[model samples]
Target: MLDDQLKSQLAAYLERVTQPFEMVASLDDGETSAQMRELLTTIQSLRSDKISLRTDGQDARKPSFTLQRVGAGTSLRFAGLPLGHEFTSLVLALLWTGGHPPKVEQDLIEQVRSLDGDFNFEVYMSLTCHNCPDVVQALSLMAVLNPKVKTTVIEGGAFQQEVTEREIMAVPMVYLNGQVFGAGRMELAEIVAKLDTGAARREAAKLSAKEAFDVLIVGGGPAGAAAAVYAARKGIRTGVAAERFGGQVNDTLDIENYISIPRTEGPQFAAALQQHVNAYDVDVMNLQRAKALRPASQSGGLIEVEMDNGAVLKSKTVILSTGARWRNMNVPGEEQYRTKGVAYCPHCDGPLYKGKRVAVIGGGNSGVEAAIDLAGVVAHVTVFEFMPQLKADAVLQKKLASLPNVDVVLNAQTTEVLGDGSKVNALAYKDRATGEEKRVELEGIFVQIGLLPNTDWLMGTVELSKFGEIVIDAKGQTSVPGVFAAGDCTTVPYKQIVIAAGAGATAALSAFDHLIRTSVPQ
Candidate 1:
C-alpha cells in the first residue's frame, strides 16, 4: 500500500492516462495476495473514472495482476508487487497501456512496432535491484507498443521457488519465448536491436554518412560527456561514439566523492551526464563500440575510428575516453560459473543469496562495502584480501569489524572457483603467509578486486603503460599526435569520477589548442 504522499503523486500521474484501463487480479487466500488486492484497490480509487479493478481471476501465479487497455489489444502482467525500484516501471506501464506516449525517440518506437515475431518475455527481478527497472520498463514498453509482444515481470523475492528452480542468481534475468535472452541492465534501444536483426546494418550506414567532427570522443562516460560539452561550446562540431552511454558508471552503486553533489547513485549520475551532454550541440552515437583507431596520414588530415559494425567515423581530433570495467578473478571455474553463482555486483545480486553464505574477493573499499551490505541479507560473508592488510579506509574497516557475520582474511590469494559444472559451490584460495591452500564452501562469490582499462582494443595502436592504461601527459595528449586520451583508460593516478571529468575538460582544451597551431593541408 502507498502512503498519503505517494497517493497524491500517483493521482497526479494518473491524469496523464488518455484512455481507460482495467487491473484484473489473479489471487488466492495468501498474505501477498491480500496485499496485492489492497494495493490494486487503492490505485483504482485514485482515478475510478478511468481505472477499474476486478478480482476473481485465474492465473498460475497468485498475487498477480494484468493491465489491459479498454478496447485495445495492448496488455501486460505483473506477477508481483511492483514496489521499491520498480514502482516507476509500474507507473509507466499504466500510462503506456492507457495510450500515453513514451518519451523515447520516434525511431525506437517505430522499431518496436515493426519487429515481427510473437515475443513472450518473462523477467525475474528483485525489488532492490537498481538495474531491474531499466529492463522491466523496456520490455513493458515493447509489450505496449506491439500487440504480438507480451511481458510479465515477476518479483524474484515473492517467487523464490521459481528462482531456485531456474537457478537464477542474478537480477533482471530475461526470458524471451521461454529461452534466456539476457541478464543485467538493458535499455530499450539495446533490446530492440537484439530483436531487429537489421538494426546494426542500418545504424552503421547512418554513422558512416556523418560528417567529420572537430572533436570525436570514443566513450560516453563522465570523461566523454565532459569533453563533448566543452568541445561543443567552442563552436565546433563534436560527436561521441559509445558502446553504452554510461560505461562502467552504470554498474556502480554509490558515488559520494564528486565535489559538487553530496551523494548520488551511479545510474542517476549517468543519466545526468547524458542529459548534460544532450544540452550541447554534440552528436551522440549510442550503442557504438570502437574496435580500431587510425591516426591521420598527414597534418590536418582526419583521424578515422572504426566501429565493430564496420562504420568508420572521421574527426579532426580524437579523444579516447573509453572507460574501465570490473577486473575479473581469472582463476579456473571463475568464468565458467559467471552468473551461475559468480557475480560482480553485490548490490544487484546480494538479495538472491539470502540466508546463504557468500565470499567477497578483495579487501578494498568496494569489497568491504559489499560485505557490509550483504551481511544484512546473507547468512555470512568471508572477505579474502591478497595484501597483508586491508586497503579499505579506517572507517570502513571499523564498520566491517563490527559485523558479527563477516570474517576478514588477509594475504589470501584466490586460486580457483569450484562449481558443479552449473553453479559455484566453493572458492579455493592460498595463504601467502603459510602457503596453505584453503577452500570455503559458499553459494555465491562477488569479485571486487579493481578495474581493467578498456584499452585492450587499442593495443599496439596507442602508447600503453605496463598496466595497459593509455600513456598521457599533463595535457591529456597521447603519444599519437591528434589523438588524446582521458579518464580511467589513461594513466590518470586517481580513477575518481571528478578526476575523469576534469581530465576530459583538459583533453578537449588541448585538442582545441592543437587545432589552432596545426596548419591546414592544401
Candidate 2:
C-alpha cells in the first residue's frame, strides 16, 4: 500500500540507520567471537520493531525496538567499544548512525566540535595489569568527544612479540601521532591537554638550542634512558642530559635479570640500551648535569637548566632522572678498598667473590637476600646482624639456614673494615652479649643496608613520601599536573631495574598525552 516516493524515503532511512549497526555487529564478532553469531541473529530478528523500518515482506511482524540517532555533522564518534565497561559505547554508536547530535557538556562539546585536524590514537594495554581498564575508558571517551580523532586499542598479548622486539616492557601505554602517552592510568584533563597543544610531538622532536626541544630528560640510568627513548620514538623533540652517559649502570658488574634481557653485564647492557635511544635520534648530552631547573612562562613554557660547567640549556619539559648515589660506609679503609673488596648490590657483585669468603653487613630483607644469593657464589657468607635475630622474613631465614655456606652472627656489629691496600682482607666486629670481640678474615664485604631517594635537590617542587620518594599516581603523575616522576625515586613498591624501566616508559607516555591535549585548540 506504499507509494513509490514513500518507499524510497523509507529505504533511505533504513540504510542510514542499519549501516552503523552492521559495522558495530562486525566488531562484536572480534570482541566475543563465541557468542557473536547467536547474538547477531537475535538482534537482527528484532531489528524491525527496534527500528521503524517499513518492509513489504509477507513475514512482517511488530518491531521490537526503536533507533534514535544522536550527534550532528562529521564529528560523530562511537563513545564505547561495546566491550567490558563499554556497554554505553554501543548506544553511542547507534546514535551516531541516525545523524543526531550527542549530549555533552556544552562548553567542552563546543570545543571538540571545533577540531579539524587528523588525530590518531592507539592505547597499549595488558590483560593482567589492573590499571589499564581505566586508561582505556578515558581514551575511548576522548575519541568519542572529538570527531577529528580516530582511536585504536591494542592488546599487549596480541602484540607480545612486537612489544618484545621493540623492548616495550610496560602496560597501559598510549601512543598518539606516533608519540607514546601514558604507561598506566592518567587523568582525562591531562590527556586532553597533551593532544590539543601538540606538546608531546614537540617533546619527541629532539630539537637543538636554536630550536629547543619540548622535553629534556636528565640522566641515562634505566629511568632516564627509557624516558628519552620513548619520547624520541614518539616523534617528540627530546634530549638526554647525562653525566658520564650511563649513570649507575657503569658501576654494575652483572645484570642477571631485567625482563627481556635475561642475562647481561652492567656496562655492556647499558651501552646497548643507549644505542636503542640513539637509533631513534634522541640527543645525548654526555658529561653534563642539569644543576637547576627554572621555569619560564612563555607560550609553550620553558625550563632553564644550569649545567655543571655553567652552561645553560632550555626546554619545555624537564625529567629529573639524576639517580641516587650509594651511601658508602664512611669507615676510613672502606673508601680505599671499594671495587677491590667492598661492594654494594650482592646480585651484581656476587660472581667476583666466587670461591672466596665474604661478609654481608645489615639485618634487613635486602641483607638477607644478599646473604642467601652470595652463599651460592662464594665459598662462605657470614651475615653480621646487630639485632638479636635476623630481621629478614621467616622464609628467607629458613632458606639461609638451609644453605651450608651461610652463617648468621647475631648481636654483632662491624666496627671497621680492615683491608690490605689492594683489597679488603678482614672485618673487626663487636658482639653485644658477653662483650665479645672478634675479627673475621674475608675477601669481600657486601653492604646491603638500604637505598635513599635522590630527591634532595627537588626541595618542595613535588610531594615526597615519608621515605623521601616522589609520590606518584598509577600513571607516574606527581602531585603537580605538568610534572611527573618515575623509577626508584617514586613510591612504587618494586625497585627492580625492569620496574624502573617500565615506570620511565609510563612517565614519558603520560607526559606525551598531556602535551597532545594541550596543543589542540579544543
Candidate 3:
C-alpha cells in the first residue's frame, strides 16, 4: 500500500497542475493486490477537476494512456536499491507519464532530430569506476538534450560474453550511428562535437579490414600488443584491435628505461613491439574501436565483436589492452593550447621545449620526474609545487636539487594560463608564502599533477578506491566474479608503465584460469 506520507506528497503535487493526467505504475508482485486497492482508494478521495488514476492492465484499449506491466516480463529491471542517483530514473519515468520526452540541448536536439536513420548506443560500464558516472551522465544528458538519441547502459562484467564477442576491452565505449567512439569518460563537448562534425564517423569508416581469431586484443600498448604475442605463441589464434596500432607508446618521444631497451624513442619501441606481435598470424585492426558486443546464447561460448566499421569478428576470449590516457589539467586554455604549448607526458613532448623555458605544475613523483627530465633538455625548468615541499622520493629530490637548470618554487599555485592563439606565451601564478602574484614567460607547460583512472565507464559495477582506482584482489579479482583489473587504473599503489604491463599479464592469466574452470564440461 502507498505510504501515508507519499500519498499526501502526490496529492499536493497534483493540486498545483490544472491539466488532465493519468497515473501509471509497475506493481511489485509481492504486494500488488493490497497496494493497488489502497492506491485506488486514495485516488477516489482526490477526485478533483482534472486528475485521474487507473490500475495496471485496465487501460490497454486507451491509446492516450498506458498501464504497462514492468516487473519480470518487462525489459527493464531495477538491479539495486533505487536510492540517491538512482532516484533520478524514477523521476524521469514519472515525467514520461505526461507523454513529454525529456529536454536536451538545442544543438544536440537538432542533430538527432534531423537524422531519419536508426541510431543505438550501448555503453559498457562499472559502478565503481570514477569516470563511469560522468560517462553515464554525459549520455543521459545527451538523451535529455536530444530526444532522438536512445541509450542503454550495460554492466561490463555481467555481460562478459557480449563484451568478448564484441571485442570491447574498455569501458564507456559508445556505439552510435553504426560506429564506435572509444573515449572512456568523454566530455559532453567532445560528444557533441563528434556528432556535429562527423570527424569520428569518417575515422571509423577508414578502418574497415576484418578477420577471425580465438582471442582479440584491443589497445596496442604494452598490455594489448603483449597479450597478442603471448596468445599467439601459446598456439591460439590471436588478433589486435587498436585505435592507432601502437597505443600510447606512439606518442612518447623518449623512453630512458624500458627493461632491455635502455634508450629508445616511443615510436621506435612501438614499431618493435608491433613487429614482434605481427610476426605471428595476428591480424591488426588499426584505427578501429569495438562498438558493440553480442554474445552467442549457445553453450559453446563463441562471442561476436562488432567494429566501428561494418566488419565483425568472432573470438573465444578477449583481452583488454586499452591503455590509460594522461589526465588533463581541466583549465580554460588547456584544451586550446594542447600540443601547441601544453602537454601531459614530459617524456613525450619535453624535447620540444629544448633550450626554451618550461614549467612543470605538480609536486608528485611524476611532476618532480618531469621537472628533472626537462631540466636536462630545456634551458630552464621551473617547478611550481602546490604543497610546501616536493612530495617526490628522496632520490628524485636530491637529483632535482643538484640540477642547475631546475628551480623549485615552494607553495606556488597557477592562477591562469595565457596563450597567444597560436601557442602559449606565459602564465600567471601566486606565491602562497609571500602573497605575491607573479607571471612567468615560458614556451611550454607540462601538467604532471596526477592521473585519473580510465575506469569511469564501468558504471558502478565494481569496487573502487577513494581516488577512483579500481579495487582488485591479490590475483586481480575485481568486485565482480568474472571481472579482473590491473595497472595504473587499479589501486596498486603505483602508476608506472612497467607496473601496468605486469598487472595486465596477471589479469590475463587470471582470466585464463577462470575461463578454464567455467568452460569445463560438467
Candidate 4:
C-alpha cells in the first residue's frame, strides 16, 4: 500500500528497532481488510527479523491490528488504516513499541509508568485532521509506557457506525473507560495532567519557585515564538508560558499564504516555529495558561503574571500574545451541542458528515472556503451570510458558486441551533430581508464567523478596545509601560501568520527599549 519512496523511508525508520514486535491483525474478507494486510505485510518486509505480521487475531473491529512487544506486556491498537495525518502516529507507535526511545521527557515517561489506574483510551480520529496525530501519538505512547494503560486509535471514516452511535461529530474525540474524556488536540503533558490529578499542584509548585525573567512572554502562537526568539537573542533571561504551544495554529489545516514558504500545513508550520524557538535560550513552559496579569507598580518593577494553577510568575517585562480563538455562534443549542453536531473546523470534521447535509454560518472567506471543502464530502452545504453580500474575495466567491452541492444565502442571521437533546438536527435562522424565521435540517453546523481575542484575562489589568482586543501603539507597547501586546489579541488589523510574527518582533524590541530607558527598581 505504500509507495517505493515511502517504503524506503519506513525501512530507514525501522532500522532503529532493537527488539522484536508482532502485528496481529483481525481483519475480515473486505477491500479495506486486504489493504490493511498489504500495509502490514509491507511493513514486515522492511525489517523481516525485527517485525512479524499475523492475521489470525480476533479484534472487535473487522479490520484492526495490534502492535505488541515480544516480552513486555505493552501494546497499542489501530482500528483502521493509519494513513494520512495519522501515518506519523503509526510509525511512531511501531518504533516506540519496538523499544525505540520516545522523544518525550524522562519525567513524563516515569510518570506514565507510575500511574496506577487501568486506563483504556479510545480516540476517534479522522485521517484529514491536522490535530489528531498529536493526540493519537500521545495516547499511543502512554499505552506503550504502561501495561495498565491500553489505547485504541479508531479512524472515524472507517468506523462510521460507532462514530454515529457515540454521537461524535468531531475528530479526535477521546474516551477513557467508555466515557467522553476530551475532544480536540491534546498534548502528552495535558493528558497526563488530567489522569494524574496532582500533576497541576506539582507543576504549580515548580513554576512558583522559578526566578524572575528579563522577558516573559505569555502565549505560544506565531507571535509568542517570534517574541521568545528575539528576546532570547538579546541575551536576556527569556521565558514563555503558553496554554498550548502553537495555539490556534495547530487547528489550521493549510497555510499557503506564509511568505517565503510556498505551501505548508498548519501543524508542520507550528512544529517548525517551536523548533526555531527551541534553538534559542528561551525557557518554554507549555500547557501553562495565564489567568491574570499585574503590571509593575513602578517603572522597572517586576510584573507579576498569575497562571491558572495559582503559580505567579514575575518578570521584568511581559509580552501578551495570548492570540484569538474561533468566534462561536451565541445561539442557544450551539454551546450545548458542540462536538455532538456543532463543529468549528471543516477540514478536520468534514468526513464525519459524509453524504449528510450541513450548514456554514458565515459568508466570509473562511466560511466560503469551508463550504467549498465540505461540498466534496458532504451531501449539501448551505452558506448563511448575515450581510447583504458575501465578504469573501471574488475568486473564492466564484469557486464557491461553482460547487454543485453548495448554496449561499445572503441577509440571513443564525438564530439558534436545533437539536434532539443529544445531537443537532436543524439550525434556526432569520431572513433579515423578509423579517421571517427559517430552519434548515442538517447533521452539522460549521461556524466560521471570525475570531475573539483571548484578552478576557487582562480585563481590569490593561486598556482594551470595545471588542476586548488589547490596545497597542505603533511600538506594540500596551497602555501599561513595559507591558506589550501583539498578534490577534491586540488591535492589529490583519491576523495573518506573517503579521503576527512581525508584531511579536516589534513588541520584543519595544520591551527591550523600555528596559534600557527605565531604572531597575532597587
Ordering by lDDT: 4, 1, 2, 3
Whichever of 2 and 3 has more lDDT, that candidate is 2
Model 3, span 1-522: residue lDDT tens: 457886677566445443344444333443433444454456546634543555453322111122122221111222222223223343343333223344544554565445443445566554333344445555654443334556555555444556555644344456775577653546454566466667455444544344455666656677666666666766766677776656666655568767776898665677787788779878776656666554443324555656765556666665554556677767678777765677665653554455789999998878888888778878998898988988998998998899998888889978877787767888788899998999999888888877676555454655778877778888667675555555666787666567766776776677567667877889
lDDT of 4 by residue, 475-496 (tens): 9999887899999999999889
TM-score between model 3 and native: 0.53
> lDDT by residue for model 1 over 208-260, one digit each (tens)?
99998888999999999999899999988899999899788888888998998
TM-score of each: 0.98, 0.50, 0.53, 0.99
Of the candidates numbered 1 and 3, which has the greater TM-score value?
1
Q: Which structure is stronger by TM-score: 1 or 2?
A: 1
Instruction: lDDT for model 1, please.
Output: 0.93
**Tens digits of lDDT, candidate 2, 1-522:** 234674454444444443333323222224333343343343344444334321221211111112222332222222212333233333444444444354444644555546568877776554433344445655655555565766665554444454444433345566777776555445453466455565333322422333566777777788888998888888988878776556666655458777777788665677787888878878776656555565554324666666645666676666667666665556767777665678775754455455789989887777888898888878999998987988888998889899988888999877788875667789998898868789999988888766777777666666888888888899887775566677777798877688888888988898788778867896
Off by over 4 Å in 4: 298-300, 520-522
For model 4, the local distance difference test gives 0.93
Best by TM-score: 4
Q: Which pairs clash (backbone N, Cα, C closer than 3 Å) in model 1?
A: none
Q: After superposition, which runs of candidate 2 have C-alpha atoms over 4 Å from their true positions? A: 1-210, 244-268, 297-300, 330-333, 336-341, 345-357, 363-380, 386-405, 419-426, 430-443, 460-462, 479-481, 517-522
Q: Please list the C-alpha lDDT of all candidates, in the order they appear.
A: 0.93, 0.63, 0.60, 0.93
Error of 3 at 477 (Å): 4.0
